[model samples]
Target: MFSIASDSAKSVRYVLEHDHADPNESIGPQSALAFALTNEHLTQKLEIVKALLAHGADPASLRNPELNPPHRDSSVGDDSMLLSPPPTTTLEAMDPATRYFISRADAPQTRHLSTLLQKSLFRPLGGVRYDIVGQDQVFEQLFTVLNLHSRTLSVSPLVILLCGPSGHGKSFLARRFGPLLGVPTHTVNVTTLRSTHDLWDSYSMSPYEEITTRTLAQFLLENEGKRCVVVLDEIEKVEEPKVLYSLLMPWELGERVAGTCSPRAGHRHIDVRQVVWLGTSNIGHDFVFEFCETSSGMSVSHGEYLELARLVRPRVSQSLGASLSSRVTTVLPFVPFTEAELMAIATEAFYSLGGERAYFVSLDIVEHVSRKAIECYIPEEGARSLHRAISSLLMDMPEFLEQSNK
Candidate 1:
């Protein structure tokens, strides 16, 4: 990383070419491309970026968005240089995946959004380490989806169904989707809606509660014509499958229907030309557990996932009905966490206690917390029990207690 940040371009090229260093690596919070641009000379900075890109560096930059937001007239010359299209020779050297995001056959007028998507999605890239673990297949699918969405102006809203057991990062992915694709994302709990009318008009859960405009229709109105993601979470929990009829128009036509059902909505049709219609459910999680009982909550093979997905579809079809189920473009099955993956999650949770990122927790404490969390894990319920296990163990620890008392 320092070699790229150094003034000598030869040092950067030599490491990537001869040493075969990973171009996508991050030294702490910054990606190699980000660190490279910090060099003193414009000539040297360009050289380092080209070297990194040639070596298959992700153009979806891991640079913090706050520092690099589409600066047009900056005093620094590197902004324009960094935004410039890579030389053809450099693009030729890049891997197909890296090349597709930045270099399109027909670069659209909205091509700049691709750069935004790159910088925003999977933020603080931390090399390849992500907050959400054990879901590489999910990430790869989204990477391509977001890239396509970024380049287009009026693609239909995509419906993706995430099917699996709970606490397996399904909700985490829903929340991450907002920043991951650089679009406004809204999540509606299908279980909470009283009727299709509740989508446009807010209703009280109880008599004491007042009405609010925080409905799905309002979310659509706010981000109308702009690319957005609306997560219909807990889709299987809705009482009547007919409630999902509200989704058909938006999912298929990129046009969210709003009638004069309520005074707030007042018969307005919202055009959601570019939107992601995401749904999460645990329809066929039982089959997953049955298949992976011997693996002890480890990994699932590609063939196994395919088999699981087939089993999942019929269950989703049963719950959502035929028409709604067919709208789902792809069903992604989130596999149960492996022992190592669970341990990593626990360690991260321990360190993140009291909103700190630094690893203040001791190695012994980390191991203990992680083991207790994993031990208490419920396969059926997923890793939701992990936090409770961790919290119970943490109360007696002095470091945790010190931070809590503060």
Candidate 2:
């Protein structure tokens, strides 16, 4: 019955009505709701789960006991789940894991569910989950690109160039593509590779070799036939222009020379057709800022920003040379954080500090630091100055504590 319903919610309803199958009844360890939650087909799973929940399925029931117990039914009702209230100070101070459960208690399609589940279930246990704030449009575009790629039978990779100021979360966003898509991410710092020799060796070295690449080649080899995101961080920082040329084949053609010594000797070719190539850059920040400044109150609409990105794409291509830049699918522009967004970041930073220290970190302090950051904000540096402002406040904590005691 469950097998028949795996692809159809109508079948599930029929099974429930005719077979007298309980929606809450455990199939193996998982209830119908839990089973639907585990379904790989997201659209079908969402539909089936919603149907089950409507038919008296308990979301709190769990297939795994070792994991945290099902969330209390405080937020759930006989008919619909209530909307989650805004985060309180207590909720803000809680760890991500706890917050995940609390937020999931009320809503099925909660904003944080995808990110939280990606961290908890998709990633390896105890992996760091980056908080990607204020990049909804980027995520939307990325999903669209991936979906389009998936629908095609082509062997070419999806190439994305992220253009933004330093420390505006471009690299972090690239790394996040892994969890979001349920694949491993391999990050290569382009600045670290000095020559083509470094490139060949880094891409082909084995576990026995001392100068082996971190995880790029190994992950590609192990996860052959699987999708992945390959992030080339700070591509603009690469010293050798020819090295960028060497990567052109891989970026455009999804074909790369696979050998330890050189491109000729033991050379075989490897294909990374299922990979997403993410290149991040701090170029064109000034141009974006200048364009935005000429707009109403220095705030550009998303459409206007995209238009600016289109203009900046040519400038970046001119700088990086036509060969490397012409193959880029799209250049995504990450704008600087607004003052309100910076304040939110500061508050989040304070909450992340945890325990007694987090309690002491007031909104007033966050506002003060965020205001300072707003004043000192530079288009080239982006949110780095804001982060530094927050860090400096934390560094002065001892002095503040001493003063408070007096």
Q: Rate the local accuracy (lDDT) of all candidates.
A: 0.59, 0.57
Q: Give the range of the ten consecutive residues with the poorest summed lDDT in model 2.
A: 121-130
Per-residue C-alpha lDDT of model 1 across residues 32-78, encoded as one tens digit per residue: 66555443333344345545654556655533442223333344575
User: Model 2 reaches what TM-score against the true structure?
Assistant: 0.62
Q: What overall lDDT, based on C-alpha atoms, would model 1 receive against the true structure?
A: 0.59
lDDT leader: 1
> How close to the true structure is residue 371 of candidate 2, measured as C-alpha lDDT?
60
TM-score of 1: 0.61
- TM-scores for every candidate against the unseen true structure: 0.61, 0.62
Candidate 2: tens digits of C-alpha lDDT, residues 67-165: 212433455765775533222212353333223333333344333333333433222211112244444445445444544554555577678898867
RMSD of 2: 12.0
Q: How many residue pairs clash per model?
A: 1, 0
